[model samples]
Target: MENAEPFHDTRGFFDKIGSRIGSQAPAVAHHINPTDALLLLQNYEESEQGWFWSTDAAGNLTYITEAIASVLGGGSRALLGKSMVSLFHKTAEGDAGSRTLPFILTKKMKFNSLEVKAAASQDECWLSISGRPHHDRSGNFLGFRGSGIDVTAQRRLSLDTARLAMFDSLTGLANRASMAKKLETTLTAYRQQKRTCAVMLVDLDRFKQINDTLGHPAGDALLKQVAERLLKVVGQGGEVCRLGGDEFQIMLPDCDDRGILGDLASKIIGSLSQPYSVEGNRCIIGASVGMAISPFDGLTSEDLVKSADLALYEAKGNGRGRFRFYSKDMQQSAEDRRLLEEDLRDAIAQGALELAYQPIVNAKSNIVEGFEALVRWNHPERGHISPGLFIPIAEDANLIWELGEWAIRQACADAAKWPGKARVAVNVSPIQFANDLFPGVIDAALGASGLASERLELEITEGVFMAETNETNAMFQALKGRNVRLALDDFGTGYSSLSYLQTAPFDKIKIDQSFVRGATEPGSRNGAIITAIVALAEALGMDTTAEGIETLDEFELIRNLQVSHVQGFVYSKAVSQQVLLENLEDGQWKIEPSGPAHHRNDRLSMYRKVRMIHENHVYSIVIRNLSVTGALIDGLYDVPVGTKFVIDFGEGQLALATVTRSNGSLQGIQFETRLVSDGNGGLCTSRRVSPYLIAEAGLDVPNLPAGYVPTTKIERDSLSLPAFSTVADWTPTKARPK
Candidate 1:
């Protein structure tokens, strides 16, 4: 080892040994002769791309070549034999004086490249360091040697990537992935220790609408503002992460008290409910929060997330701006609703639907003037389901048009079977009205049934006309030209009813059942309204119908108000066509009179009687019966068919009844009262007639006047005396005052 020509070409010895050991130990075998090793190491150390260094057994930096020192901003001579600890300024406690020393002692550690901040310039630097324990030929551990290469830019890029991976660019909070990872770890730990945790799913309501109406920049600003607000409100136990697009997920760990979850939820609601000023516009966005607690609402991450999501949907459904907790019943309800939706779609395709007719009767006459066709679903297993249950589902699924078409067709077909005078009222959903094909559907249904359009009445709520534009008006006008009667159903319920009634094209208005049900109560506002509506309809020349007339009182009240029609369970629940036909055939039809009837022993009596007097003699009498055909008195009134008679009573009691002798209106009149007062202190109501004979006599009044105007004294006196009177002197008849 004397300075013997410093064996520069020691590469041959390393090659020979490397050849014997194969390629694995080539680096170690290359440095064989101590002088040659020093020369080669010096050459490597002086190279710009490669730097060499050695660490002693005590983990001190014993040697540094000039090339390594230059890259680190110093000459090799200054760093040579200097302890590595002298280069590093320790900022954190417990950091080893030089991190490289641990690697040297733990020669089991290996590295292709590593990054470090250089102590010389205090600048971040990267190095490719590979080392093993230096040993003699006997394999005794001596020291460590490694090479270094600057990679400061690459190290900085790596740190940046790590930061970007965990943080959101806009809000600077943890992104979904990072938050999820943290949440999972926290949840797992909490579960292991039997502690509590909460997962909250927050959805900003109508945010899309806001984004659409405003601009995206405004939306972004609003989002940033929301993130800031959430950050401020999250408090100590929780962290908030934007899941994306108006949605955020919060994880509250170490929150042992479930009550605190509710409190936090309330705080969030209150905080978000406050108006936010964004881009010079005050934006108000409501938030719906659904929360799930660990080991209570759910145990696993998936379960918790799903439960919270379901609850969030529920909160949104309940008009938003609130929070809801996960519950078993809610889950079951959701499942059932899903099943119902599926079943409803299938039901429509299977044609398992039918229409039932509820008779709309004359409020005064109690005659079934028309029928309102109500849809019914006959599910194979579920029996009959009301429209209240499935109609909403159909509407939600956008299947209302198809279902509405079917209903219209069925209703029109049923109306075709009814008498020509009977009209069929079919409900039109708002969705159907919005559909462009609604008019075509109506025409097709009417054509398919061979029913006249006049016999079809389309009933819609006032809401249908809420957006009253030219298009809606045009559609309504077209329908009107087709002779389809447009009826305002459930009138007076909507806020725009008055405006709609005045503007929309409608032939009839049906007072809502709610009003009709309460019509008979004393001082009931509904009763007063019903009376006014009936009067208004009469004045406007439009028909009015009262719905939900289930009691006699309701019926009487409506009739007294002079409403044209009534429909409810009192007359009949919506029944099948066959039942209706059977009832019609059984001659069980009864038309209630317009006025209240006095009842004795459960039988209608004390009828309001109308009689005709001709030439100062009783010509005939027509009594308004309560439960039977209106009666007609025959004073040998063997009147021919279509004979119009002036029914006169001196005291404003006069009605005209055309005698249809063959069809026999007189036969239908049955007198239950024996002594009906003549209203002038005389009780003369004796009319004994054979039922068969009465049935044969046609007393039909073809031109029956609705009511008679008062007769002038001049007209009454103009009646001539009988032409066949004898020559005997006739005495003038005089009335005796009672």
Candidate 2:
């Protein structure tokens, strides 16, 4: 041991190793034996691993190991006494550098491994490290001591496994499983925070068609392009996942407002509408999207997904290429409709339906000219449900023919009690007309009621004749041959034209009430339309009835248009058969014309009173056969001289005249300056006054035969009262008898 040079060199090497270890060791381990630490370091360097050491208060290398550097490279000597920075090559400064070392020291991390270039050879090396804070048994902190190993190959293998599990190889998007997990986590957080979010389920509208027509590879390429576009649209806050072939799902975590989802859906539709070049061929594809929101459409992930799927179905049903939101009412209505459809099939068998008649009246006469048979249902449990609710159900169930036949028979039976003049207007459903037995059903109904076929009017909408084929035309002709009047109900509502009226052979066109109700407004479109319709019908030799004429003004308007008939609530609502019969028997069946002829012989009739004074011979007479235009003064006797007379007309109208001569029992007088007033301050126009002149000599006043009627009849019979000239030869003279 005395002054051995090899021993000194060995001690120097050990001391240098200790100094390097001292620099890196945590302070809490400094008090450990240096020899023991050296042994530990030697053992670590010999093994295929790495370790770091630190000093204690005695300035000894309390912790030492060199296994990590040996594993990272080839030898521990390359790492011994090298600063922690030296493990990194110059080219890999970002992986291991002063910046990272400071972070490790300040964090007091036990260890960390990073890939870096070796300072000695400038070659890349992978290192794995672990570190823990050095502390005494009492937990007094000193410094950090750690160990590390290089595991770059192991890391690469793990990364490959993760990529295979979470991503789609073709689209490079998160797979369904990963997306589901992410959605579940996000939904949980959203539920806890009471926040809103939206999930969009997107299904390509015609991906299968593309795959069929083009090729599967082309379809796959299109899907990849679609994924890229979706991601571009969704941006960072949202996640897009490929659920399966041609189906993608998007989860927008913080999207509380559904309007954003709508916007996104629109974008998706627009983007998909553009042609995509796939495998050198341009391909067009469409997409349908369904969106479900948190706490509105659903409360959980499953509920949301299910609701979205249902909405997607709805979108597809609505011709696809659109988006729909999940609505509880929609689902409920669909379910209700299904149940009602099933019940409707049985309802017909159970006779739950009935028909009631509402009177369609003549506007002028206020008489029920026809009955509009409206169907009603007396549901066993629901009691008196409207036909609007159940008739649609029957139609959907394909039970319309049965229901329509029943309604026809019931209406016919009810109409028989009404006046024979009154028509029974049975509404024919469009669905019933699709069957070949429609005409036969009408025949059966008329036969059952024993009612005259002429009294039955079949009412159908204008749409019935639209797109009419030869078969439909033949059916109509057969019905018409049985004396049934065909009325196009709700005319002017749908595709109404003069050509239809001419071609359909309709007996009448019922103008819809929308026009009739507004008819009173002068210069209104309704007035013009109604007038045109009436004119058209007249031109076609068809009767036109205005429906929904509820007001007196509307009645007047329709009457002015000369519409044949009108019906509305103004007359009465639908009633039972007994009520209708009673109403008919109550003598309310008078047909009043729409004019002033209702009161006969009540117009003003006038007769003239005449008086004559001839040289102290006073004569009194009366005029007969007075009309609005002229009169005749008859009962007068002969007078010896010319006399002035005044004649009084009713309503304070009078005239003055002079008797030029007389016959045996009559005298003729000339109207002298026709009086302007009738002595009662009422102005008399010339049209109400007439004049006469004497045309014969005097008659014997004393020897006049009693009660002798005039033999010669003048056009103006009043002129024969005396010797009067006809108004045709009479002329006005400017003179007053003095």
The clash count of every prediction, one per candidate, is: 13, 26
Question: How high is each candidate's TM-score?
Answer: 0.42, 0.39
TM-score of 2: 0.39
Off by over 4 Å in 2: 1-339, 516-524, 586-738
lDDT tens digits by residue: candidate 2, 125-220: 555555556665566665544555556567677877898699988899999999888888887787557566678899985566568656688788
Q: What C-alpha lDDT do the candidate models reach, one value each?
A: 0.63, 0.63
Specify the highest-lDDT model's number. 1
Model 1 lDDT at residue 53: 63
lDDT (10s digit) by residue, model 1, range 1-738: 111111122253234434544533346635555456445645664566576566665555545655567656676555555565455444355544345544445653445554455666755555555555566566555556666777667767887799789877777777888887887788677655766677899888657645764679888888888888888899566888888788899998755343456567767876775666676655556678987666555666777788889878656644356677665557776776578778988878888788888888876666787888988888778787767657766765668788898899888887787644678899997667756678899889988999988888999875454334456677787788788998988776544345446666788988888687545656768878887887777766689988876667667777778888888766778889887776666433554433233222112344444555444444333443322223444333223455545444222223344444423224223323333321111233222222122223333222122342323323446556532211132233522111
